[model samples]
Target: MGPGPKVKCPPRLAPCGLRLVQVRFPTGLTSEEYVKQEAWRFARLERCPFHPEGGCGLARHGTYARVSPPGCLIARWWCPTARTSISLLPDFMCSRLTGTLAEVEAVVAAADAAPTREVASEVLRPDVELPGALRWLRRRTRLVHAGLAAAIGLLPGLLARCEPTITSVRSALGAEVALVRLRAELVPHLAALPPPLGFGPRPAQRRSSLTALQQESGTDPPSGTR
Candidate 1:
């Protein structure tokens, strides 16, 4: 009888590249030394069980592999043209069994959760307030106020014809400088100012007294008194 068609084991038989690899050192080696040695070895290969399809290629084609202790390997191959290819990959194969699983899970989770350009753009939405616009508006308003103050300062000599241009120039200069000083001075003055008139308990006491007087007279309090 003809030999039956050769059965190909599923590519998934290869270890997942996403899992962490922990190599235990002999009693003589320190943990730090063991880590350095393994890191160097993995770096030389440029292909670890944690990234089996080999970096970008694996990601693009949705292929992955996982390797476990004592050289247990599993992998998944995907066909880009097939819509169901994603399902063929080992889904959520817990890498928790490995000694370094926590570190591996953390790395993988962070990579998976990283924000894309689209996500960043959405977060910094166009509707958000802009510091630049506020700064520009504030500058323009200050310029307008300075211009108005300068014009007002020149109003006193509008009817005078002798050296009107010089007078206007002087007035404008003085007004602008005065406005700058006033802004500086007014801030401190306002900081020192007490609260507005009638803001204290005196107003409430007066209102109560007025109401009592009105009640004895059996008439509404005068609007002026109120």
Candidate 2:
């Protein structure tokens, strides 16, 4: 499976073989040169997951704005077959969360380590005006737990013994990197799960473990590089 939000690309630039064009910008390309650089960045794509009929259906669909990382613009592509757009996001961003992956990881780690509600509040969001920081914490905590349960068929002993929050999960794992492990273990099917915070419009109507369930059920495909 792909490591990023699902979207496919660039083949039939002809002699380059058959595949979808990558929706990327080469390193160091300034915003000023964005349009000019589009051609080269797309050369590395695999295939359009939506419209693979003739490779002519995928078109530039523009970008989305980001905070934390100032001036960031997420690239997107339009798929006529799917009648919807799919965009690629870096590993540092979660599929539906508003914060960057690092930002989310840092907050989780801090919140997990603090021992009391006061400390947890301070560690997660020093200022109440930051609104949604704590909310994101709650939502992501559940997301991690659900993904873990779906993947391993059980929660760590400590978490099972206490509240099933990231704070508890971290304590159960007794490791500093538990959040990272959770993020890494997370699969795309998260897109379909019930959002602990709330729901937005999306195609994945119900939860299905794209990778973890298959492995747990003994029906997983061969291990290979993502």
The candidate maximizing TM-score is: 2
Alpha-carbon shift of residue 142 in model 1 (angstroms): 0.6
User: How well does candidate 1 score on lDDT at residue 174?
Assistant: 60
Tell me the deviation in Å of residue 144 in model 2: 3.1
- Model 2 CA lDDT for position 149: 47
Error of 1 at 78 (Å): 73
TM-score of each: 0.14, 0.50
Give one digit per residue, the lDDT tens place, for model 1 in 1-226.
1232233324664433332222111122222343334322222222322234432222212223233322222222222212111211111122212222222223322332446523322333335344432332222222323332333444345323322122333354464222222222233232122111000111223554445433332111111110
**Model 1 ranges off by over 4 Å:** 1-128, 157-226
Residue-level lDDT for 204 in candidate 1: 21
Deviation (Å) of 141 in candidate 2: 2.0
